[model samples]
Target: MERIIGLIDMDCFYAQVEQRDKPELWGKPVIVVQHSRRGVQGGILAVSYEARGFGVKRGMTVAEAKQLCPDLATCLVPIGEYADKADIQKYRNASAEVFDVLNNFDSNIVVEKASVDEAFLDLSIYVDNIIEKFKEGVDLILPEFLPSSHIADGHDKNENDDERISRISTFLESSQNDISLLRLAIAALTIEQIRKQIRDKTQFFCSAGIANNKMMAKLVCARHKPRQQTIVPFKYVREILKTTPIRDVRGFGGKMGQKIQERLNIMTMGEILSIDFNKVVESFPDEHEWLLSVAEGYDSEPVKARSESSSIAVSKNFPGRNAINMVQELRQWLDGLTKELAKRLVTDQLQNKRTAENLVFALATEDGRPQKTLKLVSYHPDILIDMLWKAIKPLNKASDEQTWHPKIYNLYLGATKFVPGIPTANRDITEWLNSKGKKSSDEPLTDEIVFVHEEKKVYCPQPSTSRSDSVIVLDDDDDDEKEVPITEDDEEYIEVDGKRFSKTVFKNLPVMLRKQYEHKIALETARKLKMNAKSSRKRGNSLVAAEQSHMKKHKPLTSFFRKK
Candidate 1:
């Protein structure tokens, strides 16, 4: 069976998220930049198409972005508005929401999250079903299904969408025997639906690519982006990869790929086919034998869904001049991180129904090496602060409460050892609120905090002076170099009856959060009324028995004999 893979990449994810939440940002020149106390020196993380139209691109500083587009709307990666602390739980939450929608789209269609803004979906089952329907004369690839799809045939031609879809549908009807093309064409219809549902539910648009395998699907998905789907037929697979650079494929851009290119005298993926296979295998024996398979368009990596992260962490790099040794600064940053962690835990409960059992820390010193530590306490701020502070104190023996030497360059805080902590909608908020005092008193911290410093440390250079003032954030194409999106993970939620909630948006609500407060209130009120009526009847019966007992004790009534 031919595998039909679809990859969804969110366009300008950070900026798009900002636009989705704030209506005024629609159609504006929006840009996401990493903020620093150094002001507009922070680099641009993402650029809206409107801002891009003015020649603004990623890696440019906020100043340069605004210089190009004078009215550019600059949004900061809110690692911390007050301190250089980084916490981007919000982006992670958005990512979970996007993945949730895709995961729930079709049960048989397997979805694998490639990253926060990308997912790989295996549509083999859907394709097979569609093909079966086509054979049984019970199906038709309707024109409306692929309203915004394009074919990746190395063409620069454009046509009316209505004409193109109708034309494609007619071609598909006639080419029923060609299963290869037929499956992909049908897969495009499903891809269109996936895109539509994402937009309808989330208010965030995504671009999709459909191909025979993960590699081709990812490559073609990025072909036509922002809000479109591209289909690269099996016939055109080699044709497209003929001139494609190998660096575009993951894991092939590093030293290994360069060495292969130098030794094998190959640059494009298709060149591997032209070269001698035996010699190529001999040259790079251990590392890149799979290049040949991928070059031949035979990526067999299954699209498997990953379990929720065992750990949720937030880290910030101080980098050179921004490095901190002051005790006060360190405490403040840790406090900020803990607060972010606590908030994110709530989100995790709602999204994944899980929470952490222990707190973990990684403190990177000025030498660019981290001192890893683990603690016994839960995610509570005070316990974490006391425990994490004590854990750090032993390392900084030279310093006191005010300051320390050999300043810290990086800090990471996270929660791990996840246990189920479901945020049920029917959960009693009143009881939970009342448990705050007892919970603190009931829980105990008995385990001695453990610190395990990795004796093996690699020398990492400090962030250059230029990077301090104007750091350019890069694209997330390379997993090894992916920049962590930063902001408060305070869940995208609507408040109802003083409780925060994140839900699937039916309409006006932002995806993962909706406006059903009134509806919820109505149901809760009805439930309460039913319970109260039952209680009232029970109380009335008890009162009658008590009154009768009082009358019997008094013996003042003449007609007291009733029961035999």
Candidate 2:
């Protein structure tokens, strides 16, 4: 099906809303602006059609607008005041009424609110259902063009004045079935129905367009006056766009459209469409697909409502060079932004539990050059702040004696990684330590273990000739149970039949001495296991007696005969 997209633009929305509340401003040039110095001069937020005729435009200062039309009437925009709770509720209520009316046509209709005033509606399905209603046959009749000499204003007439009037009368009398007239009548009736419904329900006036695509529809909608609609047939798409400037197309704005004009030397949409698609793509790499689609008069992209997960970012423009104070200012700004983001996350029921994958820091140069640096940060806010500070410290502390100190104008921060918070089996030890009064540098082992095992063992590795070198005999074993002299390197010792031996030689000792050494090792291992498993009601597998007995059975008598 040929897509029928409608761009419904409210004519001077703010101005109309103001005028509707205050009926005295009807049919007069009204401009909404901000009160400032130089006798109320700021961007023109909205301008009535009457004001637009007198060279008024949005973003034009009130002073400049007045210079263009000296008698222009002005009013301050109430958005800042009306953006409050009560007023926003009213605005939303009005918007809901508008949507409710549009929804009656088709539940499948896509409605996108471009702003308070403008919206794009995908009416392809709705149009398809009503196609039969507009299929009636009609004849085309062109209006007769009168010559200059035959027309007169207040001045005296020429000899052809009566002939011109007679021709116009005859043409009007002969043709009662002009196709343009019939089409316009149908369009007017349809638009009037919508307009009446909106005004009665919401007290707002909206202008609509009817065409096969968005671009032509938007253009036609703007062509007509307030509270009116215009229909562009599918056959007239080529002709209508032939002379339309490239900048006039929706989505073509500012530097993008200007670049296209400069590079392609094409002033109108028709000229752009006539060029090779590949050349257009090469010229505008960033918007190649969009330019090509517009040129072909085909757009399939659907309008969708905004989603929260799409983006969450914060940015600021600084005043001067990278001075010492700049770092403090940046930190302050980041704190404010983080606080706001945290509030929003809570409101949306989202968690910030995982580390952010991308942390971008954009730097705007004095000479219009763009440079940026990026780093990764942990999910914890404190850790993220520390990471950002470390990354920016070098730039913030650059010496004045070096190259030019480039003023930092812009900074941006964002988080790309998101993880849902779910309960897990393993708890993060570092996180738990940080939560308590303990520092991350604290040792994992107990103080007693460190002092007894580590400190005593280091001093036990010294030679002492005064100590006895005799080997002791064991009671349970024969001559094989003889004890070996303790060496300076051996710290552990075991007794066998009144004989002492180092654990290093316990394997060579008699059976009685080996069994005695094994028992000591088993006791020490079990003690450690009990400490670790204190919180568990069920005994840990590591504390099983079977495992301890296996180790005890392999100890050697000669190895256990050494002494410390």
Candidate 3:
């Protein structure tokens, strides 16, 4: 059976959400920004089409945007503002509503959300059902592209929606058994319905592309802007790919595209397809199969539904002179980011019942240095802070001759590697191993044998021993049946025959040794600190002494010449 896929992308998602909430802002330039009371201009997150006309773009400062279009409107989203408020939540809710609409379209609809603004839908099931209905002699009225107010303003006003639909429908209906053309027609009709439903309920505009696979669907979705749909016929696939840059394809946009351009000296899919398939396989050994499939415009990848994000990150950028210089400033950002992550983790735990195990902290410096990352086990807030401080300690310290402080410009904290299932009743095996097979400190061992190796003797708890039993000693097998002998000494000792043994059990040795080792470690740490301080002082003194000696050696030549 032929497959039909569609990628539906919401236009200017964040800006559109703001405009939808405020009807008065319709058709006006809008830019969404992070709110700050510090009078700093936040970078643009998203901008409306009207704003784009004025040369405004994402990642530009609010000041630059305002300078371009003084009449521009800005929506400020507060970061870490309140428990009940968030800018992302608004967009997330809008995306959820869009997905809900898609889900209600068909009982077997396969929808995969690509982002907060776009999704991929496998419309093959719907199209097959439509074909069956048509075979049953149900009058299949071809759908007309709906006339939308959100259409690009410069689109030909003379174009009629019904005429356009009739022309394409008539062309496809001319060949009844051409499954490819029929599939394209049915897919286009389905997309038209989806767009209409989305706009009617969400007051938002979207564009869609219908193709045989996701790669082509996503690439062609951008062919039409703001409330339009395009269908790529299988016969014309070569023609479309001939002129399209290889980098414009989804997976080819990264370094792989550069490598292809460098090695094959080709920049488009048409040129790539001309290369021998064996050569293509040889060049990209790892991705050979995928490379060949995509080059031939045959993508067999499936659309996977992601009900929740794999990882959640919160980051803040400090540009130019606003770079972080002090430990306190870094700590402040960490505190805020941690709070954000904590909130997100709590929400995920409640909704998905998944707990993240790894906390990744990354920082980029402004001193022409490389970015550094540290991974730690996700712990409570207090322990997390200590770990963060230790991770950043190198940046906080100074060198011997001069204070070398790094200026950090970007800070990020993310949690990943989520373990599914609820946190309760989820105990790890390592904990049991270290705890000698006990469920927890409060639980009894119960039918479990714990092997404690101490002082060349193996000890096993007797089955009759109760939960409150402590470590006890047993005599050797040679004299097991007879009573053991005792030795007279300051320390407790037991003697069997001629041999003597200490009465100190492994569990009872803590009083004599634990604190002693701890004190030794403390002393070693203190000695290292003192040595570093003394070395620093010695270097300072040597530098001063060398300067004074140089001054004495370079005595004035005038004095030796008996000044004229």
Candidate 4:
């Protein structure tokens, strides 16, 4: 079955959310700016269509935008001591509402949120069901059912206008015989319904594109503006590509796209489709299959209904003279960022049922941007700060001498990738436990093992006895147990049999093993006390013997008053 996919792009997402919340702000020029600590002139993150008419664009400073549009209304993203990075949780919440509306469209539909303001939906199941209904006693859907949308025919003039109903009638009449076109028609109809529900429920407008695959769906989505849907029939794919720039395609918007342009000596996607892409793209053999598929107007990649994001990051940019040259300023930013990041991780865990497997901290200077990745077992705020601070110390240090450390202009803290489940009861760990014939910590550990809540790493001093249990399970024979993630906090350590275990990781150990370590520590302390007392007694006897020997020598000097 041909897949019917739709891409939904929210119109001026952050700006739209602001205008929607304040009914008075409608029809006015508005832009959302990230708050700057220096003043009200932060960088613009979103620009409304009204603002764009006045030559305002995103990435311009608030002052610049206001200069362009005298009547512009500006709103700042949430900012505070903790959110020195400018928090966009409000927009994030708004996004959830939008996706919630989209998800409720049909039980068979699959929604893949592509970004904060974009999502790809697999509408094949819904379209197939609608097609089956047409085969039923029900007559074909009426043209009135087809709402306003673009056809994406590569025409200089838009044929889709107020007379969209007429166009829809003609299109439907033509598609009655061709099943492929009929599938697209049904998908368009479904999108129209979804868009109507979204606007009615959320008061937020979005544009959608319907096609046979993800690439076409995304390409056609931008053909129309807010509150509209576009459809690209299978027959029109070639004409659409004829005008589309290869860079405009999703994956080719960056460095890879530049290489393709130089190597293939082509700028347009259609030109490549006409050429022998296989013979020309020999250097990029890895991309051969994808490029060939694109040449044929096909993208077999499925719409991934991913619940957890690959990475969740927050960053703040310090432009121009606001760059941080002092170590203290960088430390402040790092402290704030780590605190904010910890909160984000908690939110992600509750929402996605997953936590980050690694923490990525990045620093951007004019010269270069450096990033550090460390294992993250615990999201404790203190641990995050300490680990990140230690990582940056080797790179930068403020001094009287012109230091090699570049002034930091941007700061970022984010999770690299998420672990599948919450740390409490991870499915992967459970599977591993079962394979080892060991019950989960929640269950008995052969001798009354207990599960503990989130705990910090606890380190014992290097064991004096070779008989102590190692960091792994005390008696487990598996020499190759997978290492669980642990915080890189240097302050916490517990050495058992010369092996190191993080405090947080050790806390997760079976209660039985933890008790053994505690008992051993007490025994070692008592033994140390006994050994010290014995040594002190020996020193006292040696001192008495030395004194008696000195008296026997009889060579002691007398005081000045009683010289002898």
Candidate 5:
């Protein structure tokens, strides 16, 4: 059985919805933004097709967009406004209406919501049925029903046009009595009825494609845009793909298309099909099979029914370097993302059944270099300020050197490893005390110390000057170096006199106490060169001599002493 796939992309979704609700803004080009601030230059969520023609694009700043077209009218995208329950219900109703209309034909129909305004429908069976009906109708309406006829004068017909006139008269008589003509009329009427039903039932204006495979069907759908249908016979599949760019094909985007072009020199789907299977595998080892299948218009991947997700993620790309102001901007984005996720979870009836585990954070430089971090949190909050802070803690510093405050362009946050936290575990005093090892009866250990296995380890070294005073007193007979059994289960805290002390306490303990308690177990480490002027002066003499000898010999250490 042949397959027909229809890719229905809405023409500027957000702008269209806004225009639909507000009749006055019908023909005007609309741009959706986050805010109307100047320096902020909020991201353009969506731009109408009319605005697109005037050089406006999604992600363009409102200020720059206005410069492109001074008359451009813009609207701030209310985050939860479009994704509200009412809006979602409306969208679902619209989708169901379209799906029901498409299901009328005898076909295996698969409808997927690609986005708010876009959906992909697999109508192979429907297309084939339509084609079969058309073929049957054509058979009925052809030569038999409309037999060739000729005009003849009575006297001349008998003499001059005897053979032709007799043949025409016989054919006309047969045409007048032909049952095929009656069947043809019936088929035509039936097609019109089907078309009318589809239009009347579903408000969505759709363009359909009838083809042998999904790829051909998709291509045919684009032949006539806005509201028209096109049918591509099985024979035209190869020719159609031959001229279409590889990027134009569904699922081929960004890096994938570039890789195909560079490795296989395949710019179009036809060229991809021409390559050998082995060569395709060599170029894209992981995705070769899938790529080949799509190239050949053979996709059997089933449409997945929507399910309640454990977590939701939202990510965004900013334009410039992330500064203090950018942090505020990130908070705003997180607020929007978290709000949307919460709304979705609540509406799906899975709110209390799940809990957000950790917030994953990622930052990208202007050139798209990314630095990612994550932090686990126990609570779900509407505003993700605490989560954001936890994620950013490792990257933040009083002095910017510890942080890569480069022109950060991208930020992302996601929750994962959700587990239901119901039926709270009973508190066990004996077990908790044993876990922390009962230090003293009066000083009850806290739960924070009890859960040591799951906590992150902190590393701090004592100052070199302080360690210099502690001299190693070795016994001649003590030849065996006792190895400390540092098991993975050991907590990061230092144990002193059967008491567990936090990392900060251990670092700032009195000098005498540290020497008495930790010096015996301390390992000797190499001294680090100070970046101060005094150290620089002393190192300068040796550096000059080393540089005179050879460039490579001192090249490595030059950057350390050089004035920044």
Candidate 6:
């Protein structure tokens, strides 16, 4: 079966996301830049077409962008304010939503996420199924919302609607291009419908390129920009690649292309195709056959659905004067970054049910070479930071030996080599086999207390209690429960590794954690029950008093007549 692949690329994805969320930014020149003060020091993330008209491009510093287009709008800042921080979450969320729409289009539609803003769809099966259904006398219905078409094959969009319809009919009826035209037409219409659905659902516009393979599809997809698509026919494949430079080809643009040009003296796709297949194979043993196939505009690669990330990375940039110098500053930044990393690790643990087995840290400093370190199974930031210090200590000593001040600009922390944790449901079986209890390292420490009390009183620490007063001596089996005295002013406390927590704090903890404070939990629960009973009795007495007062205030008329 002939292959049909489509590449859908969102236009200025990050900027488009901002525009979709903030309608007022519509039709304006919006630029999305990385987080930084004065914005220009950090790199630009995306640029709107409106901003492009003013010569603003991606990767330009905010300062350079501002010089090119003074009216450029940054997604990080309000319309009138200065841009400071780059919020990347909105773009990430938008891309996921778009992928969801593509994923559910059809079960047979094999979609591959190319990047945050681009994806490839193998619609051969979907189109084949549709065509088969259509040929069986089933009436085909076109979507009510059709995307505006960009003129393909030298066709003029200004031409009359009737003339366009006539051309389509003639192409469909012609015997020479009948099957190809019908297939292309069906694929085109389906892609158009899908694009419309994406726009309707995501409120973001995208462009697509449909061809026989990924390489050609990606190359042709960019022919028309913003909101348009181009369908490259199989017959015109050679014609399209004839004048293109070898460097313009996907694989040819990298080191492979330079090698082919330098060693093979080949500079164009046409030249490479004209060369002997044996000569090419002998010269580039591993990539020889693949190179020839790509040169011929043929790719057999399938579009496979993307899986969850194997690694998670978090990094922070300290540009220009913002670079880290002092040890105190490094400590502060490390604390914040580790806290954030730990939070994300916990979240991923809950959602993905996977644990990272390796921690990698990279720091770019004045030395030009990044200080790097890799350790095993350090998920918590606090634990990972210790490993990080061991890695950086050598770098610090080297810098000290040189007697030069080190200015660190970039810090990278990545969790990789994911290992599936013992499944929550099957953990009991695994534990029984290993004869291991639950790991204490997995528990999160309560660094900051978030008190949620009904009385809304701020917890105040009293004078320190002696060991004798605080310690509650308990027998292994005590028939009589000794009540620990806790005044309204006196808070119940439990000491763990010398850290204290009140009974109120224990009560508010999750069930898993409540068990850890078993002694205090039991007492807290009983006290709450007693307090509730007392409150309920007070309400009952108040209700009876109100009824008696009402009866005395208005006596029954029959009772008054009998008494007289």
Candidate 1 global TM-score: 0.69
In model 5, residue pairs whose N, Cα or C atoms come closer than 3 Å (at least 3 residues apart or on different chains), thus clashing, are 4-124, 321-407
Pairs that clash in candidate 3: none
User: Residue 521 of candidate 3: its Cα lDDT?
Assistant: 46
> TM-score per candidate, in order?
0.69, 0.49, 0.64, 0.71, 0.49, 0.64
Q: Give the alpha-carbon lDDT of every model.
A: 0.63, 0.49, 0.62, 0.68, 0.46, 0.61
Model 4 — TM-score against the truth? 0.71
- The candidate that achieves the highest lDDT relative to the unseen native structure: 4
* Model 6 lDDT per residue over 25-45, tens place: 989999976665453445677
**Candidate 2: segments with Cα more than 4 A from true spot:** 17-28, 34-41, 68-105, 130-192, 254-256, 273-293, 305-564
Against the true structure, candidate 3 reaches a TM-score of 0.64
- Ten contiguous residues with the weakest lDDT in model 3: 460-469
TM-score rank, highest first?
Answer: 4, 1, 3, 6, 5, 2
Which candidate achieves the best TM-score against the true structure?
4
Model 6 ranges off by over 4 Å: 37-41, 77-87, 135-181, 264-268, 275-285, 316-334, 348-355, 363-378, 391-410, 418-564
- Per-candidate RMSD vs. true structure? 18.5, 30.3, 28.7, 27.0, 30.1, 18.2
lDDT of 5 by residue, 95-166 (tens): 444445444433345565555455556554443444445443222222222112221211222333355445
Q: Model 4, poorest ten-residue lDDT window?
A: 555-564
Error of 6 at 359 (Å): 2.8
Alpha carbon lDDT at 181, candidate 3: 66
lDDT of 4 by residue, 1-564 (tens): 789999988999999989987879998999988876756657788999999999999878777887889899998887743656577766876787688778766678999989889999998887676666546323455676665666766762366455566666767777767788777877777777677767765678899989989999998898877677888888778887877888998788999888878888888877776667566668577886677678568888899885345887778777888888877777787877776676666555534545687888888887788988998756656567888878888887556533435888888888877765444432121122233344344543221112123232211121111112222322233322232333243436665434455565456543424544554456457655655665566675554454454344322111101211
State which candidate, 1 or 5, has the greater TM-score.
1
Model 4 scores a C-alpha lDDT of 0.68
Q: Estimate, for each residue in 1-564, the C-alpha lDDT of model 3 and write its tens digit.
A: 758998899999999989987889999999998654365556788899999999999988888889999999999764452221233755765676687778777765588878888889998887776666556333333343323311111232244766555555654564355766666666676677678778865788999878888988887777767677666766566667777798998888889899988877888976777888788777887877777667767788897766567787777777678777776667777766665555455445434556677777777875554434445343334455677767766665445323325777777777888886433222111222344435456764322222233332222221111222232233333322221222323545443323233443222222212222233345456655655665566665554454454345333212221211
Candidate 6 minimal-lDDT segment of 10 residues: 459-468
Residue 384, model 2: lDDT of 50
Q: Candidate 5: deviation at residue 326, Å?
A: 8.2
